[model samples]
Target: MVTDLQERSDQINSSDQNKIIIKEISIESEDQNQKKIKESKRLFNEGSALNNQNKYQEAIVCLDKAISINNQYDFAWNNKDNQLLNIIIQDMHYIIRINTKKQFYVMTKLYLLILNMIPIGLIRSNKGILQYN
Candidate 1:
């Protein structure tokens, strides 16, 4: 009868060990998910700052990384959309200013000045509006 009791106790212990292992795995996975989310938020905020500075390509890259890390990041998506709209508006302003005769040279010089302020290695032609390289 002692042998029979020992066999039953060993089976119970094995099951308990499996439960502990499963719980540990679950906790580790949760920690990794939290880290990814935190990184995503950081990237999104950086992208927004870059966007404000008119570094469109760099900003898009950062925002895309944030979205890839966390597909449910709505703020990143919104900011990306806003950046695109700002680019469009910039282009429109260029085209409108180009059509004016007296202000064309002045606007072109102003545009060049603004472009020079951007740190990115992009150039825009006076007639090309917001085209970037």
Candidate 2:
């Protein structure tokens, strides 16, 4: 009977030790998560500073790093998207400036093509009647 009681006590002690180990592991996991969050935030701040300085590409890189560390980082994603949009808008403006005449010519050709697709009967209808099908 004494041996049985001792065995039960040993089992309870081991179970308690297992619970302590699990708690320690849980604490370590939380610490690691907190560290990642801190690092991601730092990267985001750096990216924001770069963006404010008009260094869009560098800012995007920093934001990407932040997102890689924490995919759920909404601010980094938004800032990266904004940087890409700014680059696209800048490129569009440059293209427009360089190809103004070419764009106008293309638009005119498109308009003429559309006009030619209309039926002559409708275009020259009597009483100014016009219909499209």
Candidate 3:
């Protein structure tokens, strides 16, 4: 009857309204995700700039913020790792340089002591022979 037709029409309209609302929500979600990605990228760029300026600690803070915003951000994670590694490498080089200097100092002292134990006449003779060679 006409009542049945009216009821079916109401159901179709309600379903269509639901679809439209769902679509709107989906669009909003996409927009929010885009905004998040954009913000994360901005933070990442700041971190990279700081890194280039040799402000490693500051760069790491920025990169950490980027990563927190987007946990899937590979670039932020990679940069953070690189910064940490650079710090470790620099520390290692400093240690090596210090050790090398200490060894050189000890070796120089030993050389001077050995030289002093040798007679001056023998040293002079050997220096003359070395010059001829």
Candidate 4:
């Protein structure tokens, strides 16, 4: 009975050792992931600055490069591309006086209204960025 007990203890120790090794690997992988996320966000912030500077052409190039680096990045919306595009669209709305009475509230409402007017199939059929692989 003592010998059987000793064998069981040895088996449990070996199993625990394997678990420790797997856990260490998982920790290392997670650290690498955190580093990548930090880098992606940094690129995003840089893109945003480039946009704010009104260097939209240059900002777009930078944003494209950043996206290629991290396809999952959504920070480009804060950059010059969106800012410029938004300005253009908003100007159209302002020119047309679409809900001009409540500029602040109408802004969101009109924007969504515009978005809704766009055909879903057209937006999703590779016409714009809604389609992501």
- Collision count of model 1: 0
Predicted candidate 4 versus true structure: per-residue lDDT over 18-78, tens digit per residue: 9999999999999988887777677777767876776666667777766665666655533
Clash count for each candidate, listed in order shown: 0, 0, 0, 0
Q: Considering every candidate listed, which one attains the maximal TM-score?
A: 2
List the candidate 1 regions with Cα displacement exceeding 4 Å.
1-3, 97-133
Across 9-99, the per-residue lDDT of candidate 2 in tens digits comes to 9999999999999999999999999999999999999999998998889999998999888887767776776787666556655666789
TM-score for candidate 4, please give it: 0.50
TM-score of 1: 0.66
lDDT of 3: 0.75
lDDT (CA) per prediction: 0.77, 0.77, 0.75, 0.66
In the range 61-89, model 3's lDDT, one tens digit per residue, is: 99889888888787777677777756655
The reply for model 4, stretches above 4 Å from the true place, is 1-7, 77-133
- The better candidate by lDDT, 1 or 4, is 1
TM-score of each: 0.66, 0.70, 0.66, 0.50
Model 2 lDDT-worst window of ten: 121-130
Residue-wise lDDT of candidate 1 within 15-103, one digit each (tens)?
99999999999999999999999999999989988987899778888988998888777777767766765775576577667776645
Q: What local lDDT does model 1 show for residue 12?
A: 97
Residue 7 of model 3: what lDDT? 100
